[model samples]
Target chain A: MSAPFTDAQLAAFLTGTLEDETLIDAIEAAINADPALATRAEALASAEPMDASVREAFAPVLDAPVPERLIAAATPRAAEVVDLAAARAAKSAAPLPTPANDTGRSSWRWPQFGAMAASLALGVLIGGPLLKGGGAGAPEGGSLVLASADLTAMLDSAPSGQKTDLAALGEGEVVLTFRNADGLLCRQFLIEGKGGTTSDALACAGGNGTGWQIEAYGRRAAPVGEMKLAGGDAAPAVVAAVDAMIDSDPLTGADEIAELGKK
Target chain B: MNPDDTTRQALIALIPRLRRFARVLTGSIADADDVVQAALEKAMVNLEQYQPGTRLDSWVFRIARNHWVDDRRRAHNRMGHDDIGEMLDLAGDDGVAVVEASAEARMVRAAVDSLPPEQRDVVALVMLEELTYREAADMLGLPIGTVMSRLSRAKAALAKRIAAEGTVQ
Candidate 1:
């Protein structure tokens, strides 16, 4: 039997749009009976292309610190509010209206950007999240994180196993220490924010004292409908980045102190 | 919240997904953000046309797709923009086999990039964006059959190209 099914028919089968009942049944039967045909069917099914990686293809962008300019552009002013510039100015200055009330959802308050980071918006269209002094900032833009003085000091003196509950920034714990290829020291840390917001972060020494460049950060998955942009896939992305830079076993006690002192 | 505020919050939430779609359309992260920025500005200008309670992502995606065609998608062969290949490593850090798969995914993306503009639009809208043929046709102002034809042809071409890549490696 010459089973001459056109690509459209197969695609329709994949998309569940094939109109003919007989052909649909036949294709389903064939797909069930033949493994090779099934594989080809999935590939041709463009609705979810690339082995169903459609949802994941550009996921990195989802976690990249949103450009503030784009945020301004996306915000729509009221009917009488014709002054877009003024609207954007107001939007950025004030925290966005509070997220879900009393339901105990993740409180991702729109963080205020430090003045220096705000100025960078003009020149950089794809800059990382310019976190305020106390928020858990995203770690992407130019691969540089703006750490607060306290955070930097902690990175400098905090022990590998110690956890510090910081106000507004969340509870931070230094997980381990390692040396990058530059022979400079790096440390992996975890931040557990109030209401269950968790960040697994890595920072390396260098980029000037107190710069404490955040190499990568991952938020533990928050529930999807919480109005927060959770980079659920970030943990692996951060781990992969650290793995590339990781050389010797993580430092302990005295060894960690020696590395920290040099930084 | 007021309507404008509601719309603002909703749009903010979608920023990530919109940026993701823009990346798919533009390939490079830099270029993709440019498209997203343009699309957002355009979307805000035409805000009244947006119907609340409808799919905001779809509406903005329509806007973004239109803007992509009119503006930067055709911007001089995408020079100076960061190469998207570096950003395509969404596949997790496994061993060598995972890296190879990611490399192949990049090759597939390149193949998609090489497709003719019209076919590329059909693929982006129907296949990658998961829009229905009717929706895609409406957005492109073409007949559903035309969208289907383009999709079929594009799928065949991608299959052929991907097979070649698999063998080459």
Candidate 2:
């Protein structure tokens, strides 16, 4: 027991990577065992807030236009869809849609070829699947990817419409789906552009097992399917994921989403 | 609406973040934007096999990484993939304003730019984007341990670079 935890583990803990309860507990134990480590953790936690100017500087990019070139490259699926301007306007005037609801999903249609291009774009935007040193290898200044197979396996782990929380590695696309116990269809997807960019979306509906596509892009992005889920079974992706991981019994209520996020 | 079209739009919406990530990886906002644009165009062409239930960000990032690597290969320079040798050359590049930076900020930015692409990506994903190691590692397709070590080394290198510049001042 080399003091229970190492500096590297502490750093990972600071970044919220130790999500498992046991790992967290172990980390806590380690910190408690070493006063210096605990102090260091505290200092890091309270470290100066993001330099006000730095945050302000980055804010523009966060709310900036999607770039005309990017807009032109994107194929809109619906005539009624909002453009980048409208999306930015909406984001400014309203609090971004909550994570708890199915508010983000919209609809669109485009040429068949556009779909393939969009899928690649989605892969870059969504980031690659989670794997150990396989898909993409971290280069001198960039990260590496795991093998393609591991990428595929990670893709298979999510429920319908559940976007894998991956970062853009190199370039790869992932399609994900799973039905919830209530029978609703859910799907989330991503495509990477040739320039190495990534994109994503989510959507869901009732337990009818019907397809509620959770993806759409015109000038602005939209999620697929119905706009809401009732009684805590909403976010078809979350519900579906819980359903797939269960050895027995379906998840219900808030617990379902909680468990799913944990995964 | 064609199902694929809908998917494209959703994915496109993620570009701003992707651009931000790219900037971190390439050390230049222009290069990052270009990389992201290229990645997006490529991803759209391969949507059919995309299975539902996968992490979208990671998938896209993988594409971006590939594009970046390809660019590196094309440039005929492959040294320092993980080692932080050169800081970002802030003095170069004619695109994107320096964001009201002080002289020291410019120096810091240059140092960041000089970092090898590997260290650069880890810093961008973990420090700049605030991604979890698991999330960052997943995006990069590396083991969590690899990510940890990379990040550890990156921080040390950044500190050294900053310290070195300070000595010059």
Which candidate wins on lDDT? 1
| lDDT of candidate 2 at residue A79, scale 0 to 100 | 31
Candidate 1 lDDT over A1-263, as tens digits, reads 21567677777655544556666667656654655665566567443445354334344566666877577566543432333233334434444223323434323222334535532421121122232222222333323554455466678889876777555566667776888777768887766656455556677876466456666555444422333221211243344445556665668789888878777
Clashing pairs in 1: A46-B127
Compute the lDDT of residue B162 as modeled in candidate 2.
62
lDDT per residue, candidate 1, B61-156, as tens digits? 888877777664335476433354454343234578756665655666767766777877776776666777667777788755456556655665
What is residue A59's positional error in candidate 2, in angstroms?
Answer: 5.1
Among incorrect, acceptable, medium and high, the docking class of model 1 is incorrect
- lDDT of candidates 1 onward, in order: 0.59, 0.46
Candidate 2 segments whose C-alpha is farther than 4 A from its true place = A1-60, A77-263, B1-3, B76-105, B163-169
- Residue A115 in model 1: lDDT: 32
Every model's DockQ: 0.14, 0.10
